[model samples]
Target: MNGDWLAEGRAELAAERILDAVRMLFVEKGASAVGMAEVAETAGCSRATLYRYFDNRQALYVAFAGREARQLIERVWLNRSINSEAGRADQLLDAIASVLAEVRKTPHLAVWFEPANSGIVAQLSNSSDVIDAIGAGFVAGYRPALTDSAARLLGQWMIRVVVSLLTLPGGGEDEERAMLRNFVMPFLLDDTTTIE
Candidate 1:
């Protein structure tokens, strides 16, 4: 049992090291341009070894994206600045804005948001269950009244909004906020919901 545990720990460490290499590549090159051979070379592992850890480049990207998404979600969860006491509409808006801010703050993740690469990232996000679940969690955080399916649908919409902004940002932060308020908030929030 101890040997098995040790083996698992070692495997996890190796995977993390590989992911770290991939992240550095993402920072150096655009996310859409990174390849598996480059990652394996950067990671100082043979192709077979890299393949053992990640079946293909897409799989590797998914793994890396999942890690980054979870980190972003955790950071948002721990953020003290997010006004939990605000109305549900405000809270949802804040949460979505926070996600954009966090992604922008990390250059490695921000590379994926660039216009040239945003389409690839958006496609990957659409297929990523991890991102969907995180979005659902974000929605459910502020609006517990929503059913799981409703929250997920709202979450998916929120993801689309984020991707749209990342691909084509507004005039400025204020403009972005206005876009969210006028365009997004009304559609997501009910008429009875008050925005404070």
Candidate 2:
């Protein structure tokens, strides 16, 4: 009751609504079709209020992608039990499949994840600090033997491959994922090691 709980509560609600609207907008319209006003209206707030939270469309877009990536990775990590499941490629595969499949469902997010989606949203690709943070989070627990660049590149490539699968003409998720484990496993994960 002491910390201006009323204002804080209102602010939290507004932020959540705006973020949710932004995410939905991204899913429905990609980057070009949606604007701050649309996002504000979708959030059921005024554009002036939305601007108070985010400086510009790009910043909100970045926040939206960042939030999505965090949630996706958290889900994957929880499902795979990545911390406790040691040396289990199958579990890792399950986790990755879930993440990719979910991402594939969101066309705008998926499109942005691709290198080519750079045209839609700047932060979805290499230009995004949010993505870099996500990459850092992924590599944080990785074995020290794998250089930072290697770990980041491996993760980025895996994401790209799956996104490509989603947008590509024919190949299915299973095939691409299977091929990934086959070729990339040697460098990133050892067979006998258990992560969980």
Q: Give TM per candidate.
A: 0.84, 0.71
Spell out the clash pairs found in candidate 2: 84-196, 85-195, 85-196, 86-194, 86-195, 86-196, 87-193, 87-194, 87-195
lDDT of 1 at 80: 34
| Shift of residue 134 alpha carbon in model 2, Å | 2.5
Candidate 1 lDDT over residue span 1-196, tens digit each? 1223235558888788889989999999888888888887888777788898888887888888888889887787545333345576676677778878888888998999887886778777788889899888776665677888888887888888888897788787888988998998877666354323
Candidate 2 accuracy as lDDT? 0.64
Runs with alpha carbons beyond 4 Å of true place in candidate 1: 1-8, 78-87, 191-196
User: Using TM-score as the measure, which candidate wins?
Assistant: 1
Expressed as tens digits, the lDDT of each residue in 107-130 for candidate 2 is 756756544455554335545666
- In terms of lDDT, the best-performing candidate is 1
